[model samples]
Target: MKKKTPGDVFDLHQKIQSELNAQEEKQRSALRRSLSETKAAFDFFTDLGHDSTTAIALTDIALANVLEE
Candidate 1:
């Protein structure tokens, strides 16, 4: 097998980093969608004459937990 050079190592590192970034972005997108759905549910509950205070608190907690992940 041919010995790898510094340039080859650098290229491999770049490829790995690029893949990581892509995966991170995908996760972020999924989190955003989840948050949006949660917000919608909160709004729906509020519009249906449900207790606003409880709904707001629950929503806040859910969002905070998801964001902490």
Candidate 2:
């Protein structure tokens, strides 16, 4: 078998890191989008004040917590 050079290993590592960075960015973007959509929905219910159910308050609180985090 042939021996691998340091440059080869470094190149492979850089490629892996680039891929990981891309995936992490995608996840962060998705999380932000989800928070935005949830907040919009919460606001919609809030404007109408349609239901006085406990669930409404819980959902607003949950959305706040997630967006803040």
TM-score for model 1?
0.74
Models 1 onward score TM values of 0.74, 0.69
Top candidate by TM-score: 1
Question: How do the residues 1-69 of candidate 1 rate in per-residue lDDT, one tens digit apiece?
Answer: 999999999999999999999999999999999878888869976887779898887778767887799
Clashing pairs in 2: none
Which parts of model 1 have CA positions greater than 4 angstroms off? Answer: 53-69
Model 1 gets an lDDT of: 0.87
What tens-digit string does per-residue lDDT give for candidate 2 at 1-69?
989999999999999999999999999999999878776766677677656464468677777887799
| Whole-model alpha-carbon lDDT for candidate 2 | 0.80
Error of 1 at 64 (Å): 16
| Candidate 1 Cα RMSD after full superposition onto the native fold (Å) | 4.5
